[model samples]
Target: MSSQPYRLYYDRMTSAFVPHVMLEEMGVDYELVHIDTGVDAHETEEFRAINPNMLIPTLGLPDGRTFGENGAQLVMLGDLHPESGMVPRIGDEDRPAFLQWLFAIATTGHTTIRRYSYPEEYSTRYDAQDSVSEAAYRQLTRFYSVLDGVISGEPWFLPRGFGPLDIYTILILIPFEGDALADILDTRPSLARLHAATHARPTVERLWNFYFGADA
Candidate 1:
């Protein structure tokens, strides 16, 4: 129950999914403001004033403060609502490893997904876009493999149970699934199971429907 009014600026079907789900799970009062990336809404001065980087998932607080970057935002939310147990307490056994994977998925998987999705943004050479995308997909698969290896099949990333880190894993994995990448996910049993479990969560399903229509 934060006294500050919160707003999430996001694009449809984007990386903002994670924080959206997190906010729903936390049951906080907030507003969802959609921006059309295709129309360069992110690059506009008004939006840039909220987030200099013009990134989706820029969180606005009542005090006129804004926060961006998915990793920092997730950690902040978890810290703010310790009763939710989305993050471990300082002396908890899983705290160290939880933090490690949180950053791992954020830095490695998130970055690779961005490259795979928009190679043209990362590469100036039009001819190299295909090669860059291919390499990024390969790297993304490898990052998934790393995650698969770590799962002990307990339905959550950490031994303690569900946490914010699991949400991070789901966000990073969502873009790479349900098409040609299905085979890649099928090969990793643990990760696949983890994905299934994460997606089945009530909060995720509710938010998915909200953000992408009921048909989604």
Candidate 2:
């Protein structure tokens, strides 16, 4: 391991939470650099130098390299800390399922949540925002249902146990907690069980308090 700690640029409640939990779970030394998205800190030229895409959850490595995107970061971290078992090794029975769920949650699930959360980004018309959000929400529900059915293991997505797929799934779901989440959980008991189990972890509980407050 490098002598310097990894640096994570984040904004509260963003996709940054995924890697935040992963880093904590891995027990690696890392520093949190908060970028206030409310003030558009992520859009500034200075921040762009770190990550051209201006996306949060940008990770700075000890070797002076930085990268963004939650899915890519999760893969890198898992490879770096194979002992954590966040990613299954080649030829492992769970490896195929692991890759499938990881990308499914990261791309399809993440995109749907993003569309629902920020509908204005999908459309410029003020009157159309609600429609965009509603459409996204409906799609998200279907996606979640599919995931709920695929989960055949106890407390985790795969038979091998807890890994990045659970973290990615829950991170996207967190934003819906006080809103329409209960409705989603009401129908998908499997997903609800996974949510509860993920949050029940000591690391997850502590990080939840830090990012969403103790009451959250």
Candidate 3:
């Protein structure tokens, strides 16, 4: 960890979840700037000034630089702590696969989730919103299935054991709460097992309790 404190603009269960968990796992001291997107906090000029794109999960590093985009953050963190296992060492055989999966989640899975959660962003037609959401759901299901098949017999996303990519992937499933989430997990046995295992970790469980209560 650097002498200066790293700052993160975050909201519970949002894309911020990944870096939040990763920071804890890395045992680094950081500050959380909780953004209440529910009240359009992210749209305010203050927030927009920090992140021109007005996205949550924006990060300000100790070096006095800030960045948006989850995939970029992951790579930046991994580069900072190469020995931390957040990513494969550069030029390693697993490096390509790790980058591939990371980008896939960021591009395909993350976008579909955004569409599913906020269909109005995709279209102004009130009646067509349901169709947009439904299409997003279908795409999300396929993404989950692809991940399930890849991690069929493994305990982690990569053969090298748990890393930042696992944290990112697990956070991808956090929004699918309640029975809808359960039903989807049931169909993907391997993913269900992974979710359960990750959920049991101390840091993850602690965050769950803090954000969603003990029962959650």
Candidate 4:
């Protein structure tokens, strides 16, 4: 592959930020094209041609092929460039746990938050939706707590470094602003250390400013 064989179509804000963060960590050069997701720009025919789903973080390969789903992207990126150190290669023993924790963020962490943010879409009864959202919040809290425990107990989830596990999991949760998540992690010095290190990394810091900037 050339230095940058793919272009990352993404929005600086929203869920796309996660992969944006990951791609920066990958250490490989990439062509980055940022777009506003909910705006008409991303909905234009040109953009839709790449991702009919109209989602951000759609990765386009060199051969005019493209794919979505951030989880799948992480796995593929891992296999294609293990030296990036952002993920474990396919046959690595850590792959299972790496995938498990990454998926947990999608199935458990993000799913729980969904109920809170869009209760009405998921339920007909407004009252029922409230209860569901509440339950989801509690579950999310617990899951973050579990992650806190895991990170607290180790230097890294993989016993290696911040690969796909941290990339897929932590980035999803960071979008939650004004939460006690950081406070809870503070209780776990080890986890806090890891989080701090992640934030301190050059790539992550660049992404933080690029993706989270007020102008972004």
Lowest lDDT block of 10, candidate 1: 207-216
TM-score of each: 0.89, 0.92, 0.90, 0.83
Give the alpha carbon lDDT tens digit for every residue of 11-67 in model 4. 776566666666667666667777766566778898888889877779876555787
lDDT of each: 0.81, 0.86, 0.82, 0.70
Error of 2 at 74 (Å): 0.8
Compared with the true structure, what per-residue lDDT tens digits does model 2 show for residues 1-216? Answer: 568999999877677888999999898899999999989999999999999999998999877799998888988888887888878877778878888888899888999888998898999899999999899888888999999999966778887777788888787786586647898889998888888999899988787777777543
Report clashes for each candidate as comma-separated counts: 0, 0, 0, 0
lDDT of 3: 0.82
**Residues 156-182 of candidate 1: C-alpha lDDT, one tens digit per residue:** 887777666777787776565457658
RMSD of 2: 1.9
Candidate that scores best on TM-score: 2
For candidate 1, list the clashing residue pairs, or say none. Answer: none
User: Backbone clash tally for model 2?
Assistant: 0
lDDT of 3 by residue, 53-129 (tens): 99989999988788899988888887887868767888988888888889999999888888998999999899999
Clashing pairs in 2: none
What TM-score does prediction 2 earn?
0.92
